[model samples]
Target: MKNFLNKVLQQHSLIYKLILYVLTVVLIVFLFPKGGKFKYDYFKGKPWLYENYYAPFNFAIQKSQETIDAEILEIEKNSTLYFKFDEALVQDVRSNFDERIRQENYTSEIVEEILPIGQKIISSIYDFGFIDSQSESKLTSETLEITLRKGNLAFNIPPDKFITSTELLQFISSSLANSAPVELRSSMLNILSEVIRANIHFDEEFTEKAKEERIKNLSYTTGFVAESELVILKGDIVEGKKLEALNSIRRELESQVWSESNYNWVVFGYSVLVALALLMLLLFLRKYRNDIYENSTKTTLIFLNIALMVFLVTVVVKIDVKYVYAVPLCILPIILKAFFDARLGLFAHVLTVLLLGFIVPNSFEFIFLQIIAGIVTILTVSELYRRVNLFISIGQITMIYMIAYIAFTIIQEGNIEELNWFYFRLFAFNGVLAFLVPFLIFLYEKVFGLVSDVSLLELSNTNSTLLRMLAEKAPGTFQHSMQVANLAEAAANEIGANAMLVRTGALYHDIGKMNNPMYFTENQSTNVNPHSDLSNVDSAGIIINHVIEGIELAKKNRLPDRIIDFIRTHHGTSLVYYFYMQEKNENPEQVAIEKFRYPGPNPFSKETAILMMCDAAEAASKSLKEPTAQAIDNLIEKIISKQMEDGQFMNADITFKDIVVVKKVLKKKVKNIYHVRIDYPE
Candidate 1:
């Protein structure tokens, strides 16, 4: 039991990776639509490449969405508008009219005559049913008729037959114009205005309900497809009815309800496919990118990016499948290439696209477009810290999407007239969103405690806080660092290593020397050696402690670990020979060698190794009595060789050939620095 617990503790990284993989798989599968996918790939107007197809079961041939939409539009335009006829409202208006007449205290003869006229007007208005002006305006100008329902009977009448408020007043005025004198007619108009009400109101509820009933009656499927019926022959063009039939089967298969056993099988299938795609990514990392694979953080970043891309695409597909291309899948490759490398980025992008193929519509086109865009991203998006480069790359990617889509449309339709302008808009939108990559990278750096070239460029500036302090406190060491930076950068470029990384690392590698700058020979202006007063052991300790102090200072300043690596490894574990030998000769019996050595895990990458080589070569070249080409060459060889003998570069991923090329670069750069000229012939 103790051994089991110890084993679990020891393999925690592996366990974490396993958990990440499983969760990624589960999340992606969960994001996928809970439906079976059609196995065969088909396109309208394209030849059916598979064997003669048949309906697996009876299913109705579903109508196209355009057809269904057209049908609905027709129904909306021609459907009957309903209005409720209120028989009781007419009585209420009459009663109010009588009350108004009584309140006005009209003469009996005038009232008797006006009352009949008012009743006639009310009966006339209610005959066709008086409607509110608002409802009348809502009735389409082209609508010739409306259905007026009174009790259980519905009457189809011309919409103009119904009286609006304006018509009602006009009717009252015309009816009173002849029946009453001017004074009586004016008084009657005032009474009628208050009592008259719209007896027929638009029945929006009944209208909508009726429209819904009609729509429900509209056939979603035109005809039934019999089981085992030959749908389409192989090599037949998938057009018209054949296309419709094929699509109908696909729809039926996708939409059909699955039993518990079948549902579990489908879910399991999705899980397997998703797991396999991620597993391939893991295997590729393990085989070719073991450096990234071994570092759990880096591995997590890669998986997280993949999962993020998948999530974005899945969400978009869920909202609307046609807008699937609008997702900036290229951002994944752009970010990965910025932080890691192009190969890994492209590989991860391809895997992500392949996984998305299970969800997005037109899987072939989606996969092709995304993978192509990812490739373009990897190829074109260099130095992402530069805004213009990222913008230009995104433009190129957008153009590629537009061009590819146009080409596909031409192939599918045999013309450009049917090109979807909507997709082009989506692609443009996708490009706009890609501008977020830099901001996202900045966020990632903060979150993950990783550094990118952008941050490195910022640090490389001497004006930055920590670097400025280094320049102010230890000017000579700063100058030395600058020279080493140039040399290391040149060597890194020669060997195809991370030149910016090595250059930045070289700049801050010796920052610790600022603490006791004058103790070092370079910072002393006069013939004063601070080390002369101290015993050689203490002097060696001071010299060796710079690496340690540099690490502490870097941490205090919150320097990225990548830069701190140079400070930790510039001197490696080599002995401070001058002090060690001085102590050895004076007090040979008491000398302790370990006290003189720089604590180190050594340089573990090409960038760190380059810094180590350049730092040593630059500091040593200053000791040359007469700077000559041969003297410089011998100095470079001896120093590099001695360091090689001590196995300073064994752990670093630098080959002997890389070392030889780096040595050549260092020799040229050193000679240039010292102004070593060739001997003139007499």
Candidate 2:
């Protein structure tokens, strides 16, 4: 049991990486829509690239959305408007007119004459139904006819057939003008006007119901394809009928309701594809970028960026697939390049684009356009600390996206006239969103404890508090650091290493000298040899203590681990030869070498190794009697060779070829410092 526990503990990092990988895969797969994928890929006006297709099952050929919308508009424009004819209300009006005459208690002859006249008016008003005044206002002169419903039966009535309140008043005035005296007409008008009521009303509910019924019965399918029928031949241009049939099939397949067993299989298929893509990314980091692979934090940052991009794209696709291009997928590579290298950044971007291809429509065009944009991001994005560079890079990425999309449209549509300007706006919006990368980099640095070039640029400023203190307390050491920084920067540029990082590291490598300025040789101004008054062992202890003191000072000032690495590794484990030899000569048999050594894990990266080379070369050059071309070259060669012999660079990821280049660069730089002219080789 103890042995099993030991093994588990020993392999804990590997187990953690496995867990992270599995979780990422599960999350990505869950984000994906659960649906069947149509196997065949086709585009309108583009050649069918697959084998000859036959109808797999009977499916109706669906019309385009434009066609369906046009048909609905036509139905709304010309469909019959309905109104209800109230026969019971007409009889009540007649009854009320007679009752009013009886209540007046008129003379019998007067009553008889007025009552018959009032009844005649009421019957005539209702004969051509009194349409409601509110309903009459909504109609235009163009409404020549309306349908009148009497219970189950419907009558097609002309506008002239129905009477409005205005028309009813006119009818009563005209009728009495011919039939009655002035006083009698006035009395009858008052009685009939009160009795007359509109019996026809616009049946808004029934009219809407009739319209909806017509719309619901509208045919969405223009034709049907039977099973085993030939749909399209290979290499045929998919257009018109062929395009519509293929689209109908695709819709039918995607919308199919899967059984429980089929649903599981569909999810399983998505899981396998997603896992393979992520696995490739893992293997790539393991084989070519082991440094990043070993660091779980860095690996997590890369995976996290990829997952966030996928999530953004998936959400946009769900909301509206047309806006998919506006997601700014190229931000992935740009951000990765800022924190890491271009190669890893591009690789991760491509893998992410591939995963997204499954979710977006037109997989080929989407993948192609995004991969190209990602490539442009890697090539153009640099100096992330400079805002102008990021803007310029994003501009180039947007232009590439627009050009690629235009080309795709021209090919598919066979004309520029049909090009979608909507996507160009999306690409522009994509460029606008890419401005958020710097903020994201800043956020990631704080959350993940990672440093980017932007932060490094801030640290590189000499006016920073720690750097200023070094100059004030140990001016000589500060000048030495400056010289070393120049030398390291040149060497790094020559060997294709991180020049900014190496230069920044070189400036802070000797900050320990600030604590005891007079102890170091560079800080001493007079011939007072404070070290000569002490024993060689005590002198060596003070010299070695500087390296230890530099580390504490670096941490106290909150320097990044990357910069502090230079302080720890600049002296490596090499012994302080001058102090060690002096003690050895004084006490022939009692000399211990470890007392004179600097505590170190040695240089473990190209930048740290470059700092080591430049630091030793710059300091030793100050001891020369006469600085000449040959003397400088020999001095550089000897110092580097001795350091190499001590295994100082064994752990560093640097090649001997890079070392040779660094040596040549240092030789030329040192010679230039003293104004020494080079002699032409024989």
The estimated TM-scores of all candidates read: 0.79, 0.77
Alpha-carbon deviation at 432 in model 2, angstroms: 0.9
Model 1 TM-score (2 dp): 0.79
Candidate 2 residue-wise lDDT, 359-452, digit = tens? 8878899999999999899999988888898888899999999899989988888888977788899999999999999899999989887778
User: Tens-digit lDDT track for model 1 on 70-167?
Assistant: 99999998999998888888889999988888777677887887788878877877778788877887787799888988989998989888777766
Where model 1 places Cα greater than 4 Å from the true spot, the runs are: 1-34, 95-115, 165-195, 256-276, 308-328, 382-403, 413-448, 454-473, 482-500, 533-544, 552-558, 571-606, 609-682
Task: Rate residue 377 of model 1 by lDDT.
Answer: 85
Worst 10 residues of 1 by lDDT: 252-261
Please give the CA lDDT of all the candidate structures: 0.88, 0.89
Q: Clashes in model 2: which pairs?
A: none
